[model samples]
Target: MGRGGVPRPTGRGVGVLAAGVLVVLVGWLLQAPALVFAGTTLVVLIVAVTISLLFRTADVRVTRRFTPDRGVAGWSAVETVAVLPRGGRTSGTVRVREQLPFGRLSDAEAAAVLLVPGRASSAVFRHHDLPRGRHRIGPLHVDLVESYGVARRRVVASGVAEFVVVPEVVEVGLGRESRALGDGSRRQREHSLAGGEDDPVTREYRRGDPMRRVHWKATARHGELMVRQEEQHGLPSARVVIAVAAEGWPDARPTLPPTSRVGVRAATAAIPLVSDAFEWAVSFAATVAVEVGHAGSATVLTTPGGTLVARHDPDSTTMFLDDLADLRLDDAPGAPAPAPSPREPVVAVVSGLGRPDLDLLVASRAPGSSAVAVVVTAALPLGAGLTSRPTRPADGRARADDRVLAPDEVAGALRDSGWRVVETDSSVDVGRLITTSGVLDD
Candidate 1:
């Protein structure tokens, strides 16, 4: 059990045995009366030794190797603990366990390792679940007994390392590697992104841009119709609000509509729903920064670096990603979703969009009237018969429906809600969708 307190070798048994043997031999040689007592004591000592040996737990040693570093929200960890048996009492089974804080990897169970007899014949328990901090692999404890129902013993060993998890990033999808960053603030970006505002010089005009602000002096020098091309704003970085589908998040309590009966809903409860490399979202965010230049919108990230408000710079992508790598996954109370403001659009990385809450969010961003663009990152997250616009409830009273909508159907629903939905084949292709899903005209 619990160490039974620390172990310190006791020499009492050995001393007693030695004394009994010595007394017996000396007394018998001297023909003394005490020889009888000595002989009896020797027998008792032998019995004691037999009893102790019978109960001693099989000699066991443990060696544990673990990945010292962890990503954000470290619910899954990799640790291999091997148990080796020493000479005496060869083999026995042991429990390989880790102390996990409550609420981490709720789905995981404790591992019971079976140890086989012989040297180096051990059991390795990989994929140990640990929290986001240092964990002590206390001394190895082994409880064994050779003679059944007779006696038992405990053996322990020490020397364990620590695993640290920083943060988990939820990368958003952005299209062009050039458009890695979404629109950022112009003024802030100029000062922060363009080498402290001294990097770019006024240059000539181009076809697509407004012309009245042309630089006549520069035109004289360059002998061309030059326009005042002030420093291009910093890279384009778009901040997004990410959420697991309301019903899909681990802690979600699905309040099924009374209208529809609750049945077994086939929900994919794994990361990277359609394809692997869910890291695609992160790649898109980086791309946006490259294409559009910063709009300087205040970023609100769900993951560590997921949110951003500053202007984009050469290092913006790196900074954003580094921050993203810092987030950890936890099912704390889901925070209230924020309303999209006028500054820029809001992109949401969600699991399922067929839910009613999703529609309201998109509807909030009035089509053709607001700058907000709602990008829903989900893989078949809706029920069937999804409606684009908020159709009047069948009863004529306003009520959201309980229906399943395909991803393409959701795209159309978004359009009906006054949003332009850019549907992608894979949620991983968030970049392509966001780049093309900008404000669409009627």
Candidate 2:
């Protein structure tokens, strides 16, 4: 655990000791003085080496650095480790091996050789396709070997460090209306051009108002001096709701892969055992939130439990991504649905919609607001044929025993309630849909 631990003999040292004992015994039995002298010399040498290494003090420090500081899932990251001598120089070659967390690095790749430790030695390696969530790395294991290679001492050079991998954000092309979707400048221009006397973007003229800034039509309508607001731009707001309840993703629930170290880390990090459909929903939601934030919209991200990211600013997108990396699923059913943001656009990414979920979507529709729902069809519950038997004849009528609605039925219900519903499976590319399907277009 510390630098002061005693040195132990290597296999070579053990062999030499055994040979020396055997030689001494043979010399005694045969009455040979030369053999006895050689055997004694070997024993003394082994003891001397062991004693030297046991008391030897070396000040070695280990430090690790990550290239970008922040790691993203599905991206490559470089880990650099440096071993520097503090005051004293190493007497012989030192074998340095980093104690990486369970799947961070292979045994061969985690080790490095410091030939002559009179100067600092460093090792740099790249890890590809970093998994999402948190990981622990390090506690450098330094093995000090003497010139004879008969004895070695192991010491802990560094403590463990934490590495966090945030969720990946895909760039989604919002098509021709991308600029108009969340751009404050475009919204301001359109509002100013089509606004009436009661336009919220205009105000009564104050003292020292420029004549060019005066709104003549508004002034005549109000019978008072009216002026256009200076640089007034209303940035659009959006709400992204992601369903996390286990009950919402019944059909798509899959057992975590037994051999996945990332899955284990995710569970230890408090991330839930999510279904494939839920993962797709989360990724889609994350991508949309980041893209919307890039477009200068204040986006709020919520789950069935509560709000995750309250406000999306320039830096909040990263915060939201990190939060998504640790997002967990709720076990209880009937968790309260997030309240609608009156007139703001709302996008709900969900799977297996029930009647309550459908009702919430319908109630979220306001006079001027747009509601969009991305339903993961792969996770939706099956019709009566799978879950229950129909009590009535096969006349395409509603069956009394039908408890869960099918994917198409859920989409139809939401569409009837004034929602723009997009039905997709987990394998579909959301970015492709945004570009070719015009899912975000007005």
Best by TM-score: 2
TM-score each candidate: 0.39, 0.64
- Candidate 2 has a TM-score of 0.64
Lowest lDDT 10-mer window, candidate 1?
270-279
Instruction: Give lDDT per model, in order.
Output: 0.42, 0.65
**Local error of candidate 1 at residue 258 (angstroms):** 34
* lDDT, candidate 2, 1-442, per-residue tens: 3455588788899899889988998999999999998998898888889888876655676678998787877688888887777655554456666655435444456555563455767888787877666667767767777778888777777567777777667787452245435554355456658653245457887653445456777788899988766432244667777776555565434344333557566666554455656666777787777767666555667663444533453345656666666665663343343455557777788765556555755665556777788877653445621122232234868656444555667677888888888887777876776566554554
- The clash numbers for all candidates, in the given order, read 55, 0
Tell me the tens digit of each residue's lDDT in model 1 across 145-176: 32322233444444454445433333432222
lDDT of model number 2:
0.65
Question: In candidate 1, residue 98 scores what lDDT?
Answer: 42
Candidate 2 minimal-lDDT segment of 10 residues: 384-393
